[model samples]
Target chain A: EPEVTQTPSHQVTQMGQEVILRCVPISNHLYFYWYRQILGQKVEFLVSFYNNEISEKSEIFDDQFSVERPDGSNFTLKIRSTKLEDSAMYFCASSGGKPQHFGDGTRLSIL
Target chain B: TQLLEQSPQFLSIQEGENLTVYCNSSSVFSSLQWYRQEPGEGPVLLVTVVTGGEVKKLKRLTFQFGDARKDSSLHITAAQPGDTGLYLCAGIGRAGDNTDKLIFGTGTRLQVFP
Candidate 1:
């Protein structure tokens, strides 16, 4: 079965540094999303993209965050000036319909 | 903000036992999907229930959506150690002008012992 895939299973970055997490959504999927889960917390939605542009975003998706489908097979989330609180497992997902498929996730650790 | 609450965040059970986990919310969903995640892996799709009062079965697992569309349950029968993992419930928000948004439940972590 086709699945979403992400790069950089783990990343450690210093405060004020920039980071980009990349994902390859399932082929033929049109809707894409980014969500993060702090240790022992609920998954929080960051942003959703469709038609090569963002469709919606949550409050957690602030000024520092941006998403781009830079190419046919790659979607990326960039965080500028990482903060300690930015540490979490970031998951990339795509949906053809009701159910969404997810990537293994990139665990971001900010020091 | 939509909130989905899952009960019994952690569960431990013996092999061959049966167990159930629940996801509830105040908001109604147009569709709900269940997923299972293993350590170091992403959630794998299990089932999707679109209509209220719907029941779907996969192997030894069963899924049910509440009549009101505000809740759902997953039951694992004759559970084995292989069934141990985190189970998540994600519901799609009521569609508006073709936008498909989702809210995920808190998640239930189940450990099946042998």
Candidate 2:
């Protein structure tokens, strides 16, 4: 079975620096999403993209956060200026329809 | 903001014991999904319940969606050590579309002893 793949399973960056998390969703899936889970906190939705544009986003998805498909297969989440609170497990998911499939995730640690 | 609250934030039991986890929300959802996550990993979809009052069983695991679409539950009969993990319930705000984001529950971490 096909699965969503994420790169750089662990990322450590200095505060105030930029960080980009990459994901390659299932080939045939059309809907893409980004979510983050702070340690000991509930998973929070960041943004959702479809048809090459954002369909919905959560308040946590501020101006400093942006997502792009970049190419047909690669989806990226870029944080302009990393903050200590931004450290968490960032997950990527894709869905062709109802149920979404998630990748292992990228662990971002802002130092 | 919508929140899915899961009861019993943590559960520890011996193998072969039965357990049930509950997910509740004041807001209605088009669909509810259950996922299990091991530490350091993303959630893995276990089941998705779409219809209100729907019941789906996966072997020893049984899932039910409330009639009002505001709640759901997962019952595991004779759970094993392999079932030990973080269980999360997520809900979609709207119906008939996959573009909606998932509102995740607080999560229930279960530990099954052999």
Candidate 3:
């Protein structure tokens, strides 16, 4: 079956450094989302994108975070000046509607 | 904010045993989805329940939505070792602005031993 794919399975960065996570959603999907899971914690929704713009975002998605559909297929999340609390597993998801499909996820670790 | 709470945060059982996991919320949802995640992987959708009091079956697994759409349950019959994973339930709710977002549950980790 077709699936969403994310790049950089794992990443480690300094607390003040910038990082960008990339994802390629399923070809036919129109809605894209970014979610994060802290170790041993529940998954948290960050943002949702549709029609080349942000449809909605959570409080966790602050000024430090941004998302972009840079191309027809590529969706990316960028964190400016990462903080220790930013460490988590970031998952990308896509959906035509109802059921959303997820990617394997990228583990982001900030030192 | 809408929140989903899952019971029995962790469970361990022998192969061929049956188990159930629950997801509950005080707020109503338009739909609910169940997902399973293995170590180092993102959640994989297992089922979606849209209507109140709806029941869906997938082989040895069964899912039921509450009559009020505020809760759901997943039951596994004769579960196998392969059923071991973290199960998560997410509810779709409309925010104040009328946009829908998924609110995830606390999660239930299941371990089936062979």
How much lDDT does each candidate structure score?
A: 0.89, 0.93, 0.93
The residue pairs found clashing in candidate 3 are none
Worst lDDT run of 10 residues, candidate 1 chain B, spans B93-102
lDDT tens readout by residue for model 3, B1-114 = 438889889999999999999999988888899999999999998999999999999999999999999999999999999999999999887334365567899999999999
Off by over 4 Å in 2: B94-99
- Report per-candidate TM-score of chain A alone: 0.98, 0.99, 0.98
Q: List the residue pairs that clash in candidate 2.
A: none
Q: Least accurate stretch of 10 residues (summed lDDT) in model 2 chain A? A: A95-104
Mind giving the per-residue lDDT tens digits that candidate 3 earns over A3-110?
A: 999999999999999999999999999999999999989999999999999999999999999999987999999999999999999999999986788999999999
DockQ metric, candidate 2:
0.82
- DockQ, per model, reads 0.72, 0.82, 0.90
lDDT of 3: 0.93
- After superposition on all C-alphas, the RMSD of every candidate to the true structure, in Å, is 1.7, 1.8, 1.4
